[model samples]
Structures are given as C-alpha cells and as structure tokens.
Target chain A: MSHPAKHRPLIALVALFGLCLSVPAFAQFDAEAAENTFKDNDCHKCHHATKAKKGPALKKIAAKYKEKKLDEKEAIKHMTAGQKVKLDDGKEEDHKIIDTKDVKVQTNVARWMLSH
Target chain B: MDQRALILGFSMLAFGSAMAADPASIDWGKIPATKLTLFYPGQSSYEWLRSEGHKGASSETARGDSCVSCHDDAKEEQRQGAKILRGNHPLEPTTIAGKKNGHVDLSVQAAFDAKNAYLRYQWKTQNPFPGNEHQYLRFDGKEWKVYGFPKLDKVVQEGKQPGIYEDRMSIIIDDGKVPGFAKQGCWLTCHDGQRDMPKQFTKEEVAANALLTAIKKNDVRKYLPDTRTNPSDWKTGKSVEDIAKLKEAGAFVELIQWRAHRSHAVGMADDGYVLEWRLADAGKDMFSGNADSKTHQPKFMWDEKKVGYKSITADQLRKGDHFLIREQNAVPFDPNAGWKEGDMIPDYVTSREDAKGSAADNNAIANWKDGMWTVVVVRPLGLANSDDKALKAGGVYNVGFAVHDDNITTRGHFVSYVKTLGLGAKADIQAVKLP
Candidate 1:
C-alpha cells in the first residue's frame, strides 16, 4: 500500500487546529477537575444552560466576561471574593465562594465558567 | 370420508384456539417510543461539600449545571461501581473493595394515551448477580434479632452490609402547583437537615416530631418551601402548631416510588406513589413489617397454602421473573428450628384492599433479563388528588428522574436535571406527544 504523500500538509494543518482548540489556558488547568469543583461549589443550583433561575444564566455570564476581556484571575476573584449578584426578584445575595484551598483549582474552575 | 365426522373435527379445532388467547397483554409496539441516555445526578445540594459544614446552603444559590452538563457519560467515568457505598458522604474511603461504580447508562422511553402516561427504562446492573435481599429482623434461636441492614448502616459499612435492597425507579413531577421546581428540580425538596444528611435526625426525633408523625413517616425525602418558616433552616425546634399550619397550607410534593421486591410482590405498584411534604410521608407504604413479635411468623403470607412459594433454584434466577424470599408469605421465626446465620423469610406482603386511599395511583411491571431490568411504569393523567400535581394536556412541566439499582438507596441513587416535559408542544427535554 502506497502512502498519500500529497496529503501531508493538509493533515498537519488539521492537527494544529485540533491542538489549539484542545490546549488548556494554564499548564495546571484541569477541565474535568474544575467541572467537578463547579458542581461541588453549588454553582449549578441557580445558573442554567440557557435560562435564568435565581441568578443570571451561565451562558450570559460567559458572554459578558468574554466581551469584557476578563481573564481567569479576574473570574476567580469575582467568585471567591463573594460579589453581590442581583436575583430575578431584584434581591441581592453575597455570591457563594468556591470553597477550596488550591488556587490553581479555583483558577481552572474560573476558566471553565468563562469557557461556557 | 364421513361428512358428519369431518364437520365435528373442524368445530373442536375452532373451540381450542379461542381458549388460548388472553386480553391482559400490553401492546408496547403500538406506543410511540423515544430513546434517551440517563446518568446519575452527581452531587445534590443535600450532599454538597462546602467549607461551612452542611449549614447555610440553600437551593437559591445552588450551581446551575445539570448532571449531564459535567459528567456526560457516567458509565465510563465511574467504573468502580462502588461509589454508592459512600452514600454521597464518606468520612472515610469506601471499605468495600472491587465493587462496581456509578456510571450507569440507561435507555428511557415515554408514551401516553388519553388516560395514562407510560415510561419505560432499561439498564444493565453493575452486579451481574441480582440483589433482592431486604432488611430482615430474624430469630437467632433465642430473641428476634435484626439480621441485616442496607449498605448505608455503620454496622454494614465494611463489606458487611448485605447487598439486599429493592431496585427502585421514581419520577419527580411539577405541574405548576409546586413552586420553584421547574427552576431547581429535586434539589428544591432534597436539601440539608433531611434524613441521611450530615445532621441526620434520629428515630426518636422522627417519632417525637408532630410533623413527622402526622405524615406517618420516619425518614425525610422531599420538602417544599412553604412547609417551613425559613426554607433553609434545618433545625428541629418547630412546634406542632407550626407543622399544623404548614399542613393546613397544603405545602407538599408528590413522590411516587416503585420497589422491585416490595410492591412487585403483591402485584400492586400504582399504589406506591407517596406524597411528601416537609420531609414526611403523606401516605402508607403498601407492604409493612408484618412479622408478629410474639410468634415471629409473618402476619400476612402469600396465602401460600393457596399459592405455594414457587420452587426456584439459583440457575433459574438468571433471567425473567424469579421467586425471592422477600415476595413470599412470612413464616414464624422459630428459634428452636436451627436456622442458619444467613437464612431469611419472605418480606410481608399486603393485599390491594390493605393499601386503601393512602396509595398513589400508578402501575408498574418489571422483568429482569440478560443482566438488565426493563421496567414499565404507567400513571393516569389529571388525578384529582390535592397532593398530586396533575399531569395535564398542552401544559409544560418540570420533571426529575432518579433510579436506585444494585441494592443502594437514598442520596446514593442517580439523578437527572430538571427537564421540561411538554404534553403537546415544544419542550427542552421532550416527552413526545402521543396520538
């Protein structure tokens, strides 16, 4: 069987695109671990996929943060420092902090929220 | 050939064929079907691991992600199969070694007609061996002793907990009656301070509390917001006066549970739907512990003299329906009878008449075949009961689903996100329109 030598450049380009999309923002960033932290921190109870429950939708948060050019550090500070978020009922509650000592995990979790 | 003899032969053949037909068989092929993948609800608010202990956590501030949002394919992720042994909160690592994990892949289908809605689920259990053993307080040749406990018990935590529990399937429905269910789903009802939590209530506490006793239940399952003055409060300081007010206000959620070994024994399941408010059972379970303390014999036998315990060996238990000791009529525990250490009697069976108005109206049929259980649950639409959230036509409602298999129970079961089930229109999680 002869190898397709003419398609080598095309294959290389495709592989590069896949790697760019798959690489983590940080060296220590773990998407799966961060996702687990998101659930454990009770982030899912209020935010939904596309709809607003108690707070804003996650997609909305992702869009707003992305548009403003927010980095993982800023996202982590917003989540851990307990910013006041307005509810649908116009009531405000202190944001629940992501309870973890590892700052790397926290940053990874923030990146996940921003990725959404 | 004699003409008269030939005519008589034809007449006999027609009569024999007529007797063989049965009308009770369900025509599942005619029903509209859709297949879905159902995974376990990873961590509910009740089981969330927060820094400030289990206190101060409310459904209002819960995370927005659904189970599927994070852990999409559970079977591959949780392959160890023993995560349930920890009961969602393990102070220590699980002691049971080499046990299966939580990644169950389920196939679900839904169909409805004018009167009833049918939901079918199929899943291959982690343990190839079926677990039908249940809690049995047996006679130890002297005093009647509690022989076995579910895996959650402290005594049973070290690979000692008998893997004896009924596989259960439940549906949480919200039809505009229960508030915040569509947004929060089952977590609205299953929060901190309930049974099997970090701050669990003792049996004495359940017996003493007016609200718990009024509902005739010993465990907490689901509670609505209005049922408590502070929906986030998990304390037990409320007086009977407070509970009475909540009851009068009619703050409760409809919880229907179907146990393979419990309700399937006496051939009644639709009666298993229980209404829970403020973590109390609004109705009575179909089968109760029917062993007479004095005699140790079952108060209610399967009319065994009428329907003998169908003899079944271990090989016959591989597939289809098989006889379990829990499904048979109880016999008196005889201390002098030289019973073995692991010997047990059939769980007490209750008749249809015994359940009465306390039963919820839902029907179920289960068959175990090829390391899998195919369960069919049927429920009527537009029930007039005050507690039940009537499943209506042309209305979209929030629904949560949970499955308890492999002899585990409580928060250890798998859960789904709050999905929209539209009767006739478009929905986020569709339960297709029936013709």
Candidate 2:
C-alpha cells in the first residue's frame, strides 16, 4: 500500500474533499425527527442514550452491532421484528416494535440509534 | 293517629334519621357499574411518571395531562399491565414465577342515600384460593420468627420465607383538593425512596430524613408531593407545620383500605390520609401489629376453645379462614401453652371495638365466592372530620382504586388511573341517588 511521497498530499486533499461532500448526505437524516419518533413510540422507557435502564443503552447497542459487523438492515429488522430481547435484568420479553411501517422513518431511527 | 301507628311512625323517623344506610338494602342491580381494568403498576411512581425515562408521556405529564388523556383507549390498562407483568420490563424488576394475569376487571357500582355512600367492588382473584392469610409468627424449632412475606421482599426472593400476604382493596379520594390528583392520581403519592419502588431508600437515608425523624417513622410510604420541597425527593420534605397547614386546607388524599385478613373479620376498613406520610387518621385503626415490640413473640393467639386450635401450622395456610380477630377468636398469647416447633400465629390482630375517631369512620363487608371478591364499602356522607374527604352528594371527587391480590402487598398491587366519581352529579362514574 505504499504511495509516492509527491502523491500523498494530493490523496489527503481528495479524501478531505470527499468527506466534505458526504457531510450533507449524513446530515440529511434528521436527528430531531428521529428522536421525536423514538419518544412518540415511548422507546426511551427502556432504552437510554448513555445509561442502561431496562434495555441496553443506545451506545452499547451501537457498539455491539458495530463490533458484530452488523449493518442498518439488522437494526431495522430488530425494530420491526419484535423479536424476544434479553433485557439488562436477565429477563426475556418481546422487544417493542417501532410504531411505524414507513421504511424511511424506520431507517432514520435505526441509523440514529446506530450513530450513538 | 292510633297509639300503635304513632309508635310505628316514631320508629320509622328514628330509623331514617339515626341508622346508617345498609349496603344490602341498596339495589345494586339497578345502579350502573363502571367497569375499570385495574392493572399492576409495579414501580411506576410519581417520579417515574414525570422523568425522562417515561419518554412520550413525560412531557404530557409535566404539562398536567391526565394519565387517561393519552392512554384513553379502553384496553390501555390491560396493554400496560401485560407488558409490565411479563417482568423485567422497565416498570417491573422482580418477577413472580407463578403470577399470571396482568390485569383484573373491577366492576364498581356506587349508590348514595341521605347519610352514606355505598361503593361496591367486584373482581376475580388471580389465585383459586382467596388471599386471607397475611404474615405469620412461626416457631422454627425453638424461637419464634417472622415467616411469609410479599413476593417483592428480598426474603421471599431468596427463598428464606414463603410468599404470604393478604388481599386488599384501597381507595384514594380527593375532593377537588390536592393539586395534580385529578391528572396524576395515585402517582402523586407514589415516588422514589418508597418501599419496593425505584431508588428505594436506604436505612441510613431514611434515618437521616428530617421529616421521617420528626414523625418517628422508620420507613417511607405513600406521601403527597406537596409535602416535599422537591416534589420528587422523599428526603426533601417540608416542615411538619407546613404539612399541618396543608391538612388544614384539606389538601390531602384520603386513603381507605379494606384488608382481607386485618379488617374484613372486624367488618371495617382502615382510614388514613397521605400528606407527609401514609398516616392513620386522628386515632387508632382497627388493626395493629400482633407481635410484641420487645419480645418479638405474638401478643395474641387464636383461642383454642373458640377456634379449636391455639395456633396454625404451615400446612394450614389457605385451607380455611386464618384471621386472628381479637373480639371473636384471639386471646392473649400464653407463652407456656404447649409450645411446638410447627406452630404459626397471625402477624396482625383486628378489633372493631379498638378503633376510634376518624380512623374508624369507614365500614365494609366482603364475601368471596366462585373465585371472585364482592366487597361493599360504606362511607359516611357529609363528614366534617379533618381527616376525611367528606363524600357528600352533588359533589364530584377524583378517585383512584387499587387491589392487592394473590398474596402480595406494597407496590405489588393492581391500580387504576384517576376517575371522577360524582355522587348525585355528572362525572366519570356517577353515583345514583337512592329512592
């Protein structure tokens, strides 16, 4: 993977420019709307941002999915499937299905949770 | 008029003016029953209801929206209860293994005469057997020790004691007083630091609390938020004098409880109010702790002559009635009365004659048949007592109902959201005037 010394600087500049171009696309997923949807569905009753309540914290969930090499599709499946989840208390119950069938809203929430 | 007719007329006048209204005489079939689904609340206290953890409803709760405002669907209580009873839900931590049904249907009927308001409640038991046995004093080989506790208790969880508690029906009434009661109902009185609730109070913390110390209370119980400077914290209670003023202004929710074991045998319900604490009214209640404070042995034992046994054994529980009514079957404990290892005595003793003042204001009669409890509580109307809610006709009051069943106590009960009860007026559950 060695690169020419003269081309390295140009490569760094192009990568920086690419990141700048993709920032708008990343920002297009409205965080506020995702949060409102989460709240509307009362998801925060079990899930929290940083601290673990009944369910795993969003950060821990994100880290788990990332470490497991899972994608947004897996997260979406979790939100839509209502599969049995083992809570922090070592008890099992069906996870709450997100209160929406709209793929875009589900994708946004899934991505928002993963972003944590 | 003739002499016999005059005497009859005089008797009728006396009966109309002086005698209390009989619940049996009231035609319950004619009165409409409001069907409310009482659900197990677990640890969802006032603090939990308003905390960010509540998510969608926290903002609405903060803005003074009633619980029924958003959870207005007919089956909302059943839905919430089912989730919580699945156990290890956000609201529930401890799961009772054999516990099934998350909700119970309470058929409530109200009727009012000139002197009393009769509230009849009917609900099926989760267990096949009625919960009439409470905690007991057990003789484990030599020394007597406490046995049987609520499922939520650590001892019961650890298998140190069996789950044994009485079924109870409770009503918390607010006569347009106690701010937020109409919106939040019993949640305003339930908070963190209460027993079996979230953020339960430590012994040191309870001992250090100024309000608890002043009141000489060892444990935290149901209390109004207005009693505390910070509505969410149990330790931040306002001054006793301030609470007194609140009581003077009639800003407390009246707590009336009919216990299956404690008060049922005596045909009474314990009366109390929530302010700085869940305190009994002005005087003594119908039931008191049966164990002696110093000796730790039971103060009363069943009269062998009356009940055919001095004390019951572990195997005798739920086989039949085990109440230790002082007037009916209890006698002073005799330490030398052929003590045995398997003997057990009731932890509480009930006495109708011992009750006094506002604490004795409520009367109740209940029967269990076909796995259902039919309880009728008779409350006097136009009560001028400081501890009472004065359930008068033409007045609507915010009422919250709770039923503790299937051998449980404390937070392990099914509860209802706030509903208006109008006595001879328009409300959520209207009480029809008697003929």
Candidate 3:
C-alpha cells in the first residue's frame, strides 16, 4: 500500500486553509488589535505592568486567572462592560471599561490581558 | 578633650548649621531632574462634554492613548490641544482669551538637605505675554463694573466674571490623610455641588450650612472623600457631623497656590486647604480692595505724598490687552473725572501694611523671560502646624498640579493627573537626589 504519511504535508496544508476560511466570519484573537484597544482606553493610567496603581497590576491579574483558567467569554465581558471591584483600601469602584464597541476588539483585549 | 579635637567638632557643627539655615540655596543644576511630558486630558468639564457635537470627542485621540503619545512634537501637541479647546468654547478661541489649549511640558528638579525639601519647576508659556494683569473693573463714570468679557462668557453682556486674572500654578498634596487622592487624584475634590460646577448649591444653602459656607473665595477649593461624604460611600454621604469628625481627624488635602500678580506682590504664595471650596489661607489673605463696594469711592487713595499714582495712556492700554494693575498704582476713582468708554481702574493696589507677616511665609521668586516662567518656591519642611501636612523626609505623596493662565478661572484651566513626589527617595515619578 502507498504510504499515507508521505502525503501528510499536503493534507495538513489543505486542512489549515479550510479552517482559516471557516473561522473568518467569527472574531479571532489578534495580539496587535488587543494592544491597540488597551492603548486607546489609557488603561495604563492606573494599571501598571509590574506594580499595582489605582487598580491591580496586569501581571497580578494574569496570575490570578492562570490557575483558574476561567472562561475567556466571561473575562472579555467583564473587561468591556466593567464591574465593581474592591480595591486594596477596602473601597470599591466600577472598573474602567475598555473604550471600544467591536466584539473582536474586546476579545483581543481579553486575550492580551490574560497573556500579561 | 584635646584642643584640636574640640576645634574640629566646632567646625563640623558650623557646616551643619549653614546647610540647615538655607536648604533653598541648593544648586538645582547639580540635582537630577525628572522631565514630565503632560498632555491636556481633554474636556475635563462635564457640562461642556454633554453638549451637542462635542459628545464622545473627550477621549477621541487622533492617535495614541494620551495627547502627547501621538502628537510627539510639543509645538504640534499644543496647537492640536488648542484646536480642541476652541471647538468647545467657540466664541473666543486661542489667545484672544489668552488660553493655551494644551499641556506645557515641565522639568522638575528636587533637593533636600537636613531640614527642608526644595522643588524648582521650569515650563514654557503658551505665549510670551506674562499674565500679570488681574481683575480690572473700570468705573463707567457711575459704578465699578467688570472692564471686559472673558472668552468663555457670552459677548455684549458684561458678566461678573473678570476678563483678567493672574497666571497661577497650584499644587495639591496628600499625605494619606485625604482618602481617594492616591486613586482618583483631584477628581475626588472636583465634583458636583461645588461652585462653578453643575447643580451648584444655592446661596441660601451656603449661608445656612457652615460646611457649605467656607472661606471667602472666588470659587470652591478641591475636597476629598473624608469631608465631602454625601456623594459616595467610601466615606461617602458625609454629613455636618461627619465633616466635624473629619476635621477632628485632620482629614483634608493641603493646597499651595502661587499667583503671578496677587501673591507675588507680597513675595509669597497663599497656603490653604479644602472642605467644600472652603479655602482658608494659612495666614491672612491679604490685599483687600481700596474702593468701597457700596460707595465705589477710592477708600484709600494712592498716597501722592508718598508715591504719585501715574496715569496710563490709552495707547498703553493695548486694544486687546490691559490688565497691568501690578505695575500701576491707583489714585482715587473720581466718578466726576472725564471718563471715556474704555477707561480702566488701576489694578487693585495691594496694601503693604496688610501684607506684612501674613505674606512672608511661603517665599517665592518668579522670572518670566524668553516666553517661560521659572518659579522657585521655598518652604521649610516639616511644618508642625495642625493644618499643614508636614512634608517629611523620605516620604512619598500623592500630588495634583493645575495651571491657571489666559485670563480665566473655575473649570477653564489645564490640569495634570496624579503624580507621586518623593523626598530623599525615588518612586515611579521620582524627585531624585541633589549632588
């Protein structure tokens, strides 16, 4: 019998192209677009890279969810829509919402935040 | 003790004494500097943004997160910021109202010896013109009225708002007594119900409530969460009893202001604190009007016997400019004199007697040249006054800065976000050590 594995590269290429075409209609995570959303909202004004400012540090946020492996859908919703957050001082404030309407952008931001 | 050893000890003591006496004399060039590139945070005024065509444009940047992020060039950033402000206050955009649309990049240098901390700030002005001409109300041969209109107000109708005010720089300091300053910066103080803000309290409310009726001020000073409790619960919903408790707890932000003309005349800036625009200077708020309000007569004429009050010509009164009261001394406001339509009163003359000890606390020196104002303000560190936030060595503080220029007041000024300043220590926004 002809070795099926010999044609594996060709089969993989075709399958990848088909997958790309199928996913084109839905929002795919883009790192650059997520970064753009973060920048546009000036989220760094309070949330810093390493240390906490008015809000928690991005690294801490990433660490908090690293173990939980929370659903990405809920994370994106909270980031875009904002939620009440208790601060270090025991005081609470509505978390600042990212400034965008597109779901793709929101998804990208969520991915970027988790990656931090 | 050995004679040589005794002499050496005396010399060391003398050297320490000199450093303690003049901490302000530290050479700024030797000190490391922190350069801050501040951008105008856009229409900070809530009422202005809610208007038509102006909505949703508050954070709409041409590019980048903040103003300077995309508009890297200072000159270009200034112009673009001005364009935004003009779009908001359409009637008189640009320097006609003496408004600088954007943030001025500031270079701050800090030095601390054994006793005090000194900060020297240098920033370029939007325009070369020094805003020394403060409130100028001219006698229209009948009553003293505001000389002209500020750019913000509707034209033709003369508003009580003065067209001329001194250029000013202010610093709001928090030593952790004031809550939310670390998180929210100046916004904790700048909320509704304050003067010149939406839903401003009526005069009747102010008169009845001691908390509302603060110090005699043109507008309300900034408030913190501890004092202003009604709006939020992180110590929110503050009552009269709550305010008294806060005061007893010493929960208030310290405000230091340096005026170009008013306080500068006395060679000191005024120090005050806030509750609800309840501004009280650390010392006497000197420099009262010479003209009696009801009679409008010159209560105290310029003593021609001591120094003659000179008359300023119409030519000296440049068509679009003339608030130069600091330079001109005032004579009696003679209502019977031949007064023209554009004749202005001498800028309210400051009385030296009223400004003796009260004005000498916060010493300052200002020089305006080459289109920038370099002001060096010197205050002794660790003032143990009950009202003062005793700036300690190696301590960090949450600070907010504001600048008033271009003949406007209230919400019409440019502001900066929360910045941290450390004495003898370094933070993210560090005030580094002197050589």
Candidate 4:
C-alpha cells in the first residue's frame, strides 16, 4: 500500500475545507467571525486571542475547555452580554458587555475560536 | 465640612501613645465584636449583573491574581476587600433569598428582613455608573422608594447600640414605627434583619418612635439623610431639604462573605463564617452627582431618573453571576479604612504572609503592618485531602483586632477571618492550586 503519510497534508486540507463549508443556515458565520468580533469590539482593550494579554489568553482558554470544538453560541452569550471565566489563576471576573443587540463583532470572534 | 473640621470636632484625637482619631483607636487587648455589620458591594450581585454586570471583563490571569491584583492594592490599589469586610459570603443557595427555599426555619424573621431590600430601596438607583446615581430609601410597605440611606452609621456606632443587632446582617424597625409605611406598624427592618411578627419590641418599642426607617421619618433626621443631588434626573433636580419632605427609593443589593478555618491548612474544622453584601452602590462621588469611569467614587445608592439611567430588573442583574465570593483573611476591627482615591496597596497574594501559613521572614508580595489593630490582609491556602484526593488554592484572608478598655468587660472581643472553600466542592478542590 502507498504510504499514507504522503497524503496526510491533503487530508488535513480537506478537513479544513469541510469546516469552512458548514456555515449555519440562519446567520452569516465563518471561522474568522470571532476575529472580526475581536476587532469590532476592540477586545484588544483588555484581551488577546491566544495569549494572556491584558486579560487571559485565548489559547489558554482553549486548553481550559474540554470540549474539542469551541461553541460560538456560548462564546457569543458571554461576549455580547458577559460571562464568568476562571483563569488559570483562581480569581474571578464578569465578562459582561455594554450592548447585546447586533453584537456581530462578538459572534465573529466566537466563529474564529471555533475553527481554531 | 472638610475632614479637618470633623477631626477638630473632637480633641486632638489620641489612641494609646500613637496620636490618633480617638481613644477607641487604640488596640488594648480586645473589644466586643458587638456592633459590626458586613457591607457587601451591592454592585457585585445578581441585580447588578443585569445592569452593569456585562461590562469590564477580567480573569484570574496571574495564575491566582485576578481580584487581588486590582483590589488588594494597599500600596496603590489598596486591595482592601478582605480588610474592610467581615469575611466573604459564598453563594450557598441557603444564604440567598428566593434562590432556594433552603435550609432553615427562622426564615419568617429572615423573610421579614428581606436581605437586600434596604439597599434596593435606599441606595441603588437606575444608573450605577457615570456619577453613578445616589439616593435614599423610604419604604411605605407597598413600595420601597429610591432614597438615601442613613449615613448615621458612625453616629449609631458612636451612640448606644440603640439596642440594635449591630453585629449581624439586618436592622430591625419596631412596630407602629415603620418609616414610609407607618401603617405597616412599628418594625422598620433595614439592611439587616431587625424585626419579625411576634417578636415585636416590648419596652423598647414604646420608648423610641423612629424605626431606622427613611431619614424623613426619623424625627431628628440627624443621620445620613438624602440630599437631592440627582444630577441625572432630567425632569427635576432638587437640593437637600427635610428628610421626610422628599421620598425616593429603589431595589439593589450585594453582600460580602467570610470563611474561617481552624489551622492554616486548606481544609480544617467547624470554623464559623460571615458575609456582608451591598444592597446598592448608592453613594456616588458626592462632588459630582454622576459617576465617570475616570472619576469613580464608591457610593452605595442613587436614583435612576435623576441619573438618566433606566431601571434594571433583578433577573437581568442575576444573569451576570455577580455572586462569586472572594475569600480573604478577615481583617480585625482595631482599624477600618478603604483603598483611597489615589492610594496603592500591595496584594497579599503577591505581598505578605500570615503568621500561621506563611514563611517566617515574611515575603508574599505584601503584609499588613502589624502595628495597630486596623484591618489588615493575610493569606491562607485552601484545600482538601481524602483517600488519594487533595485540593489547594490561595485564599486571601483578613483578621481584625479590637481593644477592650479594662472597664469594657473581660470577654475581649475579637474577629479573625479565614478562608473556607465551603461545603459543596470538597472533592474537586483537592487538585486546584492558586498561583
């Protein structure tokens, strides 16, 4: 049999493509959605995606959640509004939002984290 | 009046050898923990979550340095959460009202007290930020009007205990003495439980007529009364007047919790605990009737209309989950103070060590100067071990001290705060470690 190793890269590409294709039917969501949310919301004010910046890092966040795929819905709930998050350290803060209506930026960021 | 005037009202103010505010300032052994009441940040609750909860997100990023970082800044931030409070109040369904029917039987009295009602009606306003609204409370039974709470806290403390339950949570109002709701009869239960049905005041009720009700109702109105400084109320902006003439109030509540341990160990014995939650952040920057993030003042209540804020629902507030109680060493009461406008206090987590669990030379990040009994911060590690299970984390603690004059009585009053992980999560807490 041909070495499966030679085709591994291609296999990964296919998986990535599949994820990109499965957009929700109701709303316009993409893997980069959360990234957009981050930008639009100016989350950089206190956060970064994969590192503990002003706030906790997004990567450490990924490690925290046991679920393989991040949930955009839940992240959005926490984003546009706010949610409770426990950093590696044992302090607590409420991640609430000022506005909830049309908070597309948050949704987009959630979409990005979901894909990553 | 300026602080100078107030200080002058009394003599040069000397406590012990140290020149101080008064004789009570000295730490002579211990004094009665008699009239201590916990003050919870009303903003740090469910009601606040719905309104202001969703803003300004943070995490315990420095391993275990989330709250301690900004709050325990004695050097700068004055992170005095623990020092100023009795202990931390955890969200045990048993403690909160309406959360669960829960554990006890004295609820009739407890219900009569309605935990955070005082704050909601008196201190909490529609807007909690941007000059944050400040108001007083006057309850007419049918409704709790937005109004200023009595600032007579010091007044009451200085005077007689007024035969009040100063050490616990609620305040009682005697029958036929209800403030706004005089019809409701005597008992005017304030922030703490001060009344119940059959337990009506006997001789005391007949003597004093004013229930710690609304300032207006309190004939003397010598206490903390509402001075109409509603900068936000678009329609009407009034000034201070008779306490009774103007009536306003709303709903807001918050609390502080405490957990005590026998030894410095994470998990120990049947240590008692207490929690003080705030009903509202009604006290605004008195300089400005509004609150600005840049210029934030920790006021406990405000009226929404005057502050241009829309009223918020408790359900909306609860959604933010403001109940994550922080544990700390309970600072004793020989002294009392808060993080000032431009002050800096180091985090005990990063600063000092408690005598019990700490390394001798003393090095964490901060340490409470062991000089006077003023409330100071300490640290305790929390954990549990059973079978092959072990859990541990850093818990900020507080211990307070009081001095009892030789004449005050020998029971030497004292209070030292310890951290408790509480009863529920003993199992999962084993492996956890605070950075």
Models 1 onward score TM values of 0.65, 0.78, 0.64, 0.21
Q: Which sequence of candidate numbers ranks them by TM-score, best first?
A: 2, 1, 3, 4
Model number with the top TM-score: 2
lDDT of 3 by residue, A1-116 (tens): 66489898998899999988885222356777775556545565466667776567778887787678664576777776678877676866666676568776777777777777
Once model 2 is optimally superposed onto the true structure by TM-score, how far is the C-alpha of residue B134 displaced, in angstroms? Answer: 0.7
lDDT by residue (B1-435, candidate 2, tens digit) is: 012233223323433444466675677899999999999888898888887667545655877878865565446687778878876588888878578888999999999988888899999998888887889999877788888999888988888889999899999999988898998899888888888888888999988989999999999999998899998889999998999999999999999998888877677778888988999998888899998999888899988887688898988778887777786678999999988898999889877778888898888777788999998888888888988889888999999999998888888899999999999999989999987
* B-chain TM-scores per prediction: 0.73, 0.94, 0.73, 0.17
Q: Model 2 clash pairs?
A: none
- Deviation (Å) of B281 in candidate 2: 0.7
Candidate 2, after superposition: displacement of residue B398 in Å?
A: 0.5
DockQ result, candidate 3: 0.05
lDDT of 1 by residue, B1-435 (tens): 111232224323422333221112446565445444444433345345222442233332344334343333333224223333335434323343333455556666665557666667777776775454455544444544455555555666765544556677777766655565666567776655565555666777667776667656776655665565555553343555765554445444556666676655444353422223432133655566756767665444322343354222222333332222232333333344444443434444443334545363655656566788777766667776555556766767777777776666665566665677676656654444455
In order, what DockQ does each candidate have? 0.09, 0.03, 0.05, 0.10
Best by lDDT: 2
lDDT of 1 at B1: 10
lDDT per residue, candidate 1, A48-109, as tens digits?
65677556777798888778977778878877888887766676778878778688788888
Off by over 4 Å in 3: A1-38, A41-116, B1-26, B39-100, B114-116, B148-150, B154-162, B204-210, B213-221, B232-244, B297-341, B351-353, B356-360, B428-435
Candidate 1 ranges beyond 4 A from true positions: A1-116, B1-43, B46-99, B159-161, B203-210, B213-221, B234-250, B270-284, B293-297, B300-342, B358-360, B428-435
Instruction: Give one digit per residue, the lDDT tens place, for model 3 in B320-392.
Output: 2222222233445555555555455544555323543323345555656687877666556777666667777
